[model samples]
Target: MKKLILPILLTICVIAISCQQKEKQNSIPKMVNSDGSYETVPLEKDTLVLKLIQNSVRNVKKIENAKEVVNENLQKVKNLVVEACTTGDKPNIVLMHEFPLTGYLYGGRKDKVQMALQIPGEETSELCALAKQYDTYIIFGSYAIDPEWPDHILSLTTVIGRDGEILKKIWKPRNIKRFYSSFEITTTTVESVREKFIEKYGIEEELPVLRTEYGNIALSTVQLDPFIFSAFTMKGAEIILRTSTLFFESDIIYTAMANNVYSAMANIPADSPYGGNSMVVAPSGKVMARLDKTTEGVLEAKIPIAKFRENRKLPQYAIELTKDIFKQYQEEIPANHLDMPKEKLPQNGKEMKVLLDSLSTWLNQ
Candidate 1:
C-alpha cells in the first residue's frame, strides 16, 4: 500500500508540471491599440530586419583604380554583416547608398562608361556572393552599361536575393543631365537618354515591389516622386527602400506616414557634399534609427510587421486629401502625361534664370 501511494504522488507531481508548462506556452502578452483597447496580438512568424550602410567614397586618381576602392568598401560591408550575424541579430535585408561601386562623377560619357559595370557582370557577381555568404538580401546602386548600348551608361539599383540571384534591377529614370550637359556631353541629352532607357527598360509607370519573406519592398532613388510612393502603397508595398546621394528628411517622413509603411533611406558620407543622414522611419513617420550626417556606419532596425499592418489600417489625412484631389480632377487629368515643355532646357546659368522667369510667368497666367 505504501509503494502504491508513493507512485501515485509522483504521478500527480508530473501532471501538475505538465499543466504549468502548457499554460505558459498558451499565454501571450497583450498589446494596447491606438484606441486604448488591449488585445492579444499573435506573434509574427518572421520580423522584418534591415541594415542601411552609409558609406563614404575614397578619392582615387583614375577610374580604373575605382575597382580597388569598391572592393575595400565591400569588405567593410561584409565585416559589418558578419558582426551582426555573430550578435544573433542578423538583418534580413541590407541597403547600400547610391553610387556604392563608383562615386557619382561628371565626365565624358566614354570615360564614365569605362568605369561602369555591366549588370550581372563581375561586380554584381561579387555582391551576389556576399549576399549568399550572409544569407541576406542586398540592394545596391551602380553606374552600369547596358549591353545594347556599350557607349551609354545608366544608373542602376539592383536587388540581390539570399540565394545569390539578381531579383530585380531598376534603371534610374532621372540622372544629372544638367551637369553632363554643362560638359557638352552629347550622350547625356535628357530626351535621348530617356528614349534609350525606355528602349531597354520599360517606362516606370509604377514602382516595382519585391515580395519577400519579410514583406513587399520597393526600391527607389533620390529622385522619387510623391506619386510614385502612392502608387507603390496602392500596389501593397509594406516597405520602401530609398538609396540616395542626398537625404530629404521631410519627404521621407511624409512618405512613411502617408503610406503607412516603413521607409528606409541610405545616404553616403558628406565627402562629396551630397551625402548625409542615413535613417529608418517607422510606419508612424517617426525616425527610428539614424546614422550621423557625417559619419560612415551601418544603421539597423527591427520593424514589426504586425504594427505596420495596424498603422496601415489607421486613417491617414494625406491619403484622404489625395483621394479628394483625385476626385476633383478625375476628368481633367490625363492618365499619363509628362509636364516637360517643348522648348529646350536651359543650357547655362543665365539661360536657367530666363527659363525660370518664363515658367513663373506661365504659372501666374
Candidate 2:
C-alpha cells in the first residue's frame, strides 16, 4: 500500500470533531471533505492495522555496499511484521509487499538497482515462510532473472501458499532488462493460476462498464504505470484503481477534475543495507503501509480526506504529521551519527520510531 499523497477533496457536508476526539473516530472516520462523498465513518480494526503496517517500513536500507546491513534489517522487519499478523491469530490474511525498484529515475540512476540486480535467496525463503505460517498471500515486487530467457530482469514474484509454490508472475520492460513484474497469488493446489490471473489482470471480461460514486472511472487492459498491476477505471466516479506488486506506483488513485494521488511508496531491498527501512518521495507524497517478514511486522494507516476538509487544511495537516515524525527520528538518532557510512544507511531506528509513532497518532488524530 502506498502512502496517501496530496489532499483528496471530499465534499461531504458534515461537521468534523476536533483532533482531540480522533481516538473515538478511530472506529469512526471523520469527514475531511464536504462534498458529500462519504458520511463520517469508522474504519474496521483490521483496516487500521493494515494502514499502520504500510508506513512502518518506509526506507529499508540506504547503504551502498552494506549487504550484511541489508540482510539484518530485513530480518528485524520480518519479525516485527509477523508478530503483528498473529496478534489475534486472524484467520484469513492478505499481505501485499509493493517493492518499487525502477519507479524513480533519479539522476539517470535507478534507486533500487541493488535489489533488482540479483534475487536474494535468503530473503525469498523468509517471505515464503511468512506466507506459509500465516497462510498469507503476498504481492511481492523485485527484479527477477528469467530462467529461460537470456537476460537479467526485474520482476515481481507472485509467490503464495508457502513452500516455493509460484502462482503467477508478471514482468516489465526497462531497457534491456525487464523492470516491472506483477501477478496474482493463489494456493499451490489452485488448479488454474491462469484463471485467477485473468480475473485480476483481466477484469474487463467480467465487467464491461463499472460505475463509481465520484463520476466515471475507465477500466482498461492497460496495466498501471511503473509496474502494470491491474487497472480499473471507474469513469463514472472519475477514479482509477490499479493494483501493482510494487507499492510506490498508483495502483489506486481517485482522479477527479482537479487532483490525483501519486500514491506511490519506495521499494525495500530484499537485503536492506541499513538497519531498517527507509522510503523516499517528493515532499507531497505519502506512505500508507509497511509490511515485513516478522510476526509484528506490518503497520498501516491512512489520511482520510474527510478528516481535514472542514477548512481545506487536511493536506497540510498530513504534511505536518509526516514532518514532525521525521523530526522526531532525527532527534532520537542523528542520521549523521549512525555506524554505517552516510550513503549506505537508511533512516536510523529512531526515524522509524517517529514514523511508527506518527502513524499511531494519525489513527488517533
Candidate 3:
C-alpha cells in the first residue's frame, strides 16, 4: 500500500510539471510576418489572440491601400506637369522666313543700364515678323498695355513662335518669373555690389562709369531662376532695350554658333511655366541630351545622347544633376545616421533604412 501511494505521488508531481511546461509554451512569444519581414509578438495568445491577429491583418491591408493611394497621387501630379508643356503645336517651316528677328537679354531693373540702347520700332516689328517667318521663337522685351485689358500697364516678356503664331500673344496677366530666379549676379546690380565692396575696402573707384544708377522709372525686372531675369522699360508707349542681368547676355551678339548659341533668343522668363531645364529622351525613354540650367540662369548644356539612355527610372535630368552634385561634393553629405534633420529623428531612421534597402535592391537589379 505504501509503495503504491508513493508511486501515485510521483505520478502527480510529473503531471503537474508537464502542465506547467504546457502553460509556458503557450505564453512564449510568437513571430508574425509583416510586409516582407517578421515581427515578434507583443503579448501572449489567449481567447483574444485571434481578435488581435484579425486586427493586425486589417491594419496591413490598410497599409497596402495607403501605398496604392500615394502612388496614384504621384502619377497624377507628374501627368499634369507633362500635359501643361504640350499645349501648343509646332510652327510651320515656311512661315519662319518672313519676319526679321532681333533678340537681346536684359537686366530687370532700370538701374542696370547706364547708357541707352535704341532699337527702332520698325526694326522691332520686322524682327517680330521675321521670327514668325522662320518658325523661330523670339522673346522681345517690350512695354505695352493690352487694348482689351486696360489699366494693366506692364513691361512684358513677349513670346512669339515661328508659325506666325504668338504662343503667348501677351503674358503680362500670367506671373511666370519666380520659377527660374536663381542667378545672383546681373550687370545692373554688379556696380552696386562693387561699390559696397569698395567702400568696405576703402578702395577708390577704378572707373567713373562704375557709378550706380539711382532712378525711379517704373522699370520692371523678372526673376527667372537662379541665373536669369528680364528687365524692360515702358515709357509712355515705347519699349527699349535696357541692360541685362546676365554677364554673358550680350555674348550671343558675337558667338551665334549652333553649339554655343541658345536655341532661341526668346525663351520664357527663367521661372516661366515651362521652366524645367529640358531633358530629351530616346523613344525607349533613355536620356539623350539635357538642357541644364547655366550659371547665368540660362538653359545651356546639351549632354551626350548616350547618357540619356542609361537611366530608365529616374528622370535623366534629375539623375545627371544629382550625380554631378554628388561627384563634386560627396563629402558634404552626412553619413546615414547623421544625415537627417533633428526634427526628423523619430521617423527618418526607419524610412531611411527602408529606402537604403530598396536602393540596394535596385542597384543590384
Stretch of 10 with least lDDT, candidate 3: 49-58
Q: Name the best candidate (by TM-score).
A: 1
Clashes of each: 0, 89, 38
Q: How far is 326's C-alpha from truth in model 3 (Å)?
A: 26
Q: In model 1, which runs have C-alpha deviations exceeding 4 angstroms?
A: 1-44, 59-61, 175-206, 271-274, 310-365
Q: Which stretches of candidate 2 lie over 4 Å from their true place?
A: 1-52, 55-66, 88-91, 94-97, 100-120, 162-164, 173-251, 255-297, 300-365
Poorest stretch of ten by lDDT in candidate 1: 330-339
All candidates' TM-scores?
A: 0.68, 0.35, 0.22
Q: Mind giving the per-residue lDDT tens digits that candidate 2 earns over 179-255?
A: 22321121011111224433345523322222322122222112323222211221112222222323323333222
Which model is ahead, 1 or 2, in terms of lDDT?
1
**Superposed Cα deviation of residue 340, candidate 1 (Å):** 17
Clashes by residue pair, model 1:
none
Cα lDDT of all candidates, in order?
Answer: 0.66, 0.33, 0.27
| Best first by TM-score, ranked | 1, 2, 3
Q: Kindly list the per-residue Cα lDDT of model 1 for residues 38-117, writing each as its tens digit.
A: 22234334577788888776533367776787677667766755665456478788898877766765454446667667
Candidate 3 structure quality by residue, lDDT tens digits, 1-365: 88799899999999999999999667643322223222112211111100000000011123225334324432432232223222232221111100112112132322112111123333345445655544444444433333332222233434444444444422221222112333222121212223333344322211111110111111113322211111111111011111122222222222112111111221222333332223222223233333333311212222221232222121112335576775775322122322233343222224434433443433445
Clashes of 2: 89
